[model samples]
Target: MHETNVGQPESNDDSDGIDQAWLQRRTAAAPLILGVVAIVTSVLMLGMLFGALGMRAGIDLWRAGNRRWSVILGVALSFVGVVVSVMCAVLWGSVLASVLLSRDVLRETERWRGQRVAAVECSMLSADGVRVSSLHPAPPMDRLVIVFVSSGIDACGQALQDLAAVAPDHPTCSVLLVDRDNSAATTRAFALLHGADFPVLASETLLPEPLGSVAALPTLVVLNRDGVVECAVVGAHPRSELHTILSGAQPVVATEPKETQGP
Candidate 1:
């Protein structure tokens, strides 16, 4: 047989020039390869990272000699990737914040139950700037609903919205907004903003026993004529659910706050 160079390709030089050939091939393909990677990653939400890689490779390739379509394509991919990455970042950030809020609301709700003890008549400063010292009304209303809230909390905000709708419909029931952060002025503003016409009360200390442990906002404690807790729940409730809880004509499961409107 004629001289046979077993596995080596005829076009590839011997070891002396192999490195140079390998480097040339690698340099030529890098921009196109990275550009494809960046484009693919853009669809998978990893555009920003791969985009940077493609940009460097494209710049290096352009500096070598000519501006090929591959070089332009590489640069274009970087621009598109950067834009896509920024938009996705904003959208995902908003979604993450909302989920975190809901998670906090659910955490507080899942652990607590309704209290049947005396409604702790802690001292409070009313929204009108008058000092009051009771969880109950002067005449002792037929029913009482005390809502605990903190400033800038979404669950509390949502609960207040529900209260605005149901509080007025049931005049016999007394409703009060208890401020957890001692933000009397802010709470008053919140009450007005959410349309909760009920009394907004704030205290500098933790509310008394059975309630002193309350560390979460948007906690609703319902009491009977005797000023004893009949139902206590955490988290935001819907208008209809609030109405039912206040009415008591129907059985109200108030140990844990529920998503009354969602499927």
Candidate 2:
């Protein structure tokens, strides 16, 4: 009769411990589950509203050292969603407006190129106070390739090195580098790093009409012997394309060896 068998204290403790473990597991999985939901929502919304949030969550998860590949894939998907959303907005808003906007952009680009070409035709004072036409003095070659560079830009340095590498192969083409900042120390360092043979010019006021007003670095300008800007490229060009530009502008010089007769 009397007292019922006392429940085992150890069993109660074990049950309590199992419950705590289950709770901890659920708590740990909550953030991951929320992240997945956010990513799915972002995709459904075309990334217009929740795309950035989802991307941030993915990045945070990666930083937290959890599911690296999943986070990367999620980040990529979020980026695509954002881009798609933007494209959709642009396309759906007004097709005519988009076309007109693109046309205006192209026109502006062409206008800038024209200004640069015109600037190349103008005269500029060199570092030595010598009045030089275009960016640099016209080289004693059939064609001239002027590479605009800056002190801190990596692309400019790469373009300079590319030109230097191809300089020997193209005898008729001369490669000249113009430092936009006019930093003598940087110019010297660049020359030393790349090669001493590549000529470097330091002029602050060079191309005052175009380059002086704007900060467009790493431009490649190809000119004919007549000092006319044949092709004015606004960014770094491929080595093959650079070669093509030079080769296309190569002047056909006809020379006949004079015959000498000795008596």
Candidate 3:
């Protein structure tokens, strides 16, 4: 009877060991899933915060109506929220993804940080035809891509269509198109035709000679984010070429001097 009791204790010990091993495996996997959830939640929260701020600013702008100063202040504050929102999203996602996936978050963070964008102002016929200049003081050493098209060139209609297709895939890049003529009706029509998500400026003023020399119609130029002209293509280009340009590598087209373009 005493021998039988001793064997029972050994059997119980083995059962406990098995249970512990099972729990250990579960413990290891839980963090990866939990970490992902935490990271996603953090990003979503930030997005909500920025989205709310933008809405508030928009409302305030509407209330102020033609009050230029009030509208300007509201717009400025809204931009602040946008910057913060983006930082939070990237940081949160990178940290969590790194921890869960056991990868370097720094590389991911840098990938996002490398992106630089310029909002080109297009005024076709107006005295204030040059709005792209306002985005200066941009990140140092950024490439400048220019779209110089006139109404005669289907600048708005086709340009917007091309942009909408490309923008989502290349979130790290900036795109600006200057309409050779500032035709409000044409601009509106272009917007209606191609659900353009980026800025499309209309100007009546002809693009300067140097810019005209680089790009003619349905043209795309890939510039280094430093505001230097990297490569200029006279006409439409393929997706692969654009991707190459975004990576700071020259596309397999014309290598141009920076002197022809502005940052």
RMSD of each: 8.1, 15.7, 23.7
Tell me the deviation in Å of residue 159 in model 1.
4.4
Per-residue C-alpha lDDT of model 1 across residues 51-132, encoded as one tens digit per residue: 8887887787788764667677767777678678778878888899988976776665434434344444555545456665
- Name the top lDDT candidate: 1
Candidate 2 residues 1-263, lDDT tens each? 67555765544456676786675454445444444554555434446555676577766666765554555666666666677667766766677686677566444333333232333543333334434455433556766676677766777777777777767778877666677676645675775576535555545444544334433567666656544555556556788887777775443332232468999
Off-target runs (Cα >4 Å) in candidate 3 are: 1-137, 140-142, 152-159, 182-185, 202-209, 212-215, 251-263
Error of 2 at 52 (Å): 12
Write down the lDDT of every candidate, Cα atoms only: 0.69, 0.58, 0.48
lDDT of 2: 0.58
Q: What are the models' TM-scores?
A: 0.60, 0.49, 0.38
All candidates in order of lDDT, best leading: 1, 2, 3
Kindly give the stretch of ten consecutive residues in candidate 2 with the minimal lDDT sum.
Answer: 109-118
Instruction: Kindly indicate the candidate among 1 and 3 with the higher TM-score.
Output: 1
Locate the minimum summed-lDDT window of 10 residues in model 1: 250-259
Error of 1 at 56 (Å): 5.2
Per candidate, the number of residue pairs that clash is: 0, 0, 27
